[model samples]
Target: MFKWEQLHQYGILIIVLEENNEAKWIIALGDDFYYDQNTMEPPVGDILLYEAALEDNEVIPLQYQKE
Candidate 1:
């Protein structure tokens, strides 16, 4: 599963790629910023959700919506 988080209003972005079986993560920030699993260093809030999702085996959205 992959998720996108726009951390800044000025176009800063974070993209997370997940592979359940292999425990992989790739974080991308902005157009030229990319990090592999080893260098993936998400923010505090992001890490929280990431860890939760890993433990729960679910895809957790970055934010809640009214629906």
Candidate 2:
């Protein structure tokens, strides 16, 4: 139930609430940006899901997660 605009900043952060009611946050950088944790970069128009949570006022990354 999230919108693209909601994740258009601060790179990309995905929040997933599990059945246990726990939230996880996944942090991702853009293809143009460099990341040691990621081997490959996500292409444009790609939506990457992550196990992460968002702060009250945080910007989501527009980049996708590698593989």
Best by lDDT: 2
RMSD of 1: 14.4
The runs of at least 3 residues in candidate 2 whose Cα sits more than 4 Å from the true structure, single-residue gaps closed, are: 1-15, 25-44, 53-67
- Model 2 misses residue 40 by how many Å? 29
Evaluated at residue 18, the lDDT of candidate 2 is 39
lDDT by residue for model 2 over 1-67, one digit each (tens)?
A: 4444333344253334333344444345434554455645434543444555454635454545445
Give all candidates' CA lDDT scores: 0.38, 0.44
TM-score of 1: 0.20
Q: What are the per-residue Cα lDDT tens digits for candidate 1 across 1-67?
A: 3434322122345434445533354233323333456754633333113432446555443432334
Looking at model 1, residue 62 earns an lDDT score of: 49
Q: Give candidate 1's whole-model lDDT.
A: 0.38
